[model samples]
Target: MNEQQFSKSMTYAPGLPEGATFYSAHKKRVTSHAVANAVEAALKERGVTIEDIAEIVLDLQKPFMSGLTIETCAENVRGVLAKRELQHAILVGIELDRLAEKKMLSEPLQSLVDQDEGLFGVDETIALGAVSSFGSIAATTFGYLDKVKPKIIGRLDLEKEGKVNTFLDDLIASIAADASSRLAHRVRDEEEKRLSQNNGK
Candidate 1:
């Protein structure tokens, strides 16, 4: 199809108004802030607020970084959520859980997601894949949180009120893990700079 036809056929371009011109629709720029807000809204609708995830981030870094504030943790969490890849992960995982809740997925697959089958590792797989860009520290942190299921992660996993959070719990863990990794590296960079300056002086 020609570019015009292709653009016209696109009815669901993100951050674009309905029936927008082909040029406007195709050329529309999706800002990081918009994606982050959408992801945060999805989490809030699922009863998982930014603050809820930030608490996990705070707990993860507080011991290692003294005087780490919840606001800083929350900012890092927002930074992680703003990433395009991570945003994609959160939307996909949450949509799957939502579909499972509505019994929309096919059998066997439906049962796996709905029951959060222990053998079904795809949930963690997606979560880890999204955060892998952050490096090994983020991946290890994710594994630790997945195993421990701390705070909100633990509560989400235990939910049995017809809520399917198989992927969500892992996704949240990955976000918090990534945020912790970012904070750690940033602090380490600052410390290294300070040490270098002191030595020079």
Candidate 2:
């Protein structure tokens, strides 16, 4: 189908409930298709692609799921949040946007995000949040990242210093992943409602 048809189809999704427009107008509601689109757009804006993100997330999902004991991850995440990294997060985002404008990530940027280096954890968090779009998981994960990234920066070289274990990173990363998944589900629900309402009109 053409882009116009695709956009129209999205506006009138099946099984949408009443009162869904509030979510859409406020941009709080999201559909899976929308998530897909948002992810694509954000990547393109960065001169990166879905493959780049998918590669990182896929690497994360397995070890991130297995070895990261919940408590440890939470504690590590808490440590990151304690440092006050909101401005830092924004600065990093701007830097990334610049890199996109330049059509490539620097070698430093590549190592940090692609390799998931300890120094660039907050950057990773924001990127995940943006592309995930309107998912509760994304919101909450980004919220957590936004809330505590500076602390993580302050606590860098944690593994080298033996201050952290796999468990800690795992928990924080898991928090992000779970939050995004949940966000996707909620967005879909609200989106269905919005689309149904529009159809009823």
Candidate 3:
């Protein structure tokens, strides 16, 4: 049925509250899978892929992890992407960038975002807030990438025309940093498990 028909068909549960109504079609239950898909789609629209972030994670983690595979790095990146906190940050930051690209923002804000001015630190702030959940390692790694602008981050930062990636570049860095931190902790856990098994023997 059409949306209006569907909305009309919905009935409120037994309740005494006056003017209370059932959820509408626009308020349909959102699934975790749908949110995850949107986050992935947002990244893809901005020319980023899981592998792109995974490569940075591998660069950050491989030195300390023997025989580390790109597949493992990609897996950890996916794991980080699944967090609601990170997903929220990705959506918000990308939306801002998109708005800026369309010059929808006002005055100094629009100019700052479009130019990605040196004084414009809000982008990094949002990215850092999201990565902070992963602890100090992730936070510091984000700072490094923000400064160095390695690989995809560098490319995004350098794009001047027809795009505004002020927030996206830092968001990508944060994602990679957080994933690397997660992989590090996972490796440490596995090592400890092995050591504990050896001690038990």
Write candidate 2's Cα lDDT for 1-201 as tens digits.
Answer: 454334423564444443332244323343444433443344355334333323323343435344434344334223332222322333345455445335466777544543445565655555444434325644555445434533332233143421222122332333344433543454468779999999999
| Cα distance off (Å), candidate 1, residue 110 | 0.7
Q: In model 2, which regions exceed 4 Å deviation? A: 1-158
TM per candidate: 0.88, 0.25, 0.86
Tens digit of per-residue lDDT, candidate 3, span 1-201: 566665532444433232333345544444566678889999999999999999998888877888999999999999999999999999999999999989899999999988889988999889999998999999999889888989899998888778899999999999999999999999999999999999999
Which of 1 and 2 is the better model by lDDT? 1
Ranking by TM-score: 1, 3, 2
Local error of candidate 2 at residue 189 (angstroms):
1.2
Worst window of 10 by summed lDDT in candidate 2: 161-170
| Candidate 1 steric clashes | 0
How are the candidates ranked when ordered by lDDT, highest leading? 1, 3, 2
Q: Deviation in angstroms for 190 in model 3? A: 0.2
Q: Candidate 3 lDDT (Cα, whole model)?
A: 0.87
| RMSD after CA superposition, every candidate | 3.0, 16.3, 6.8
- Which regions of candidate 3 deviate over 4 angstroms? 1-29
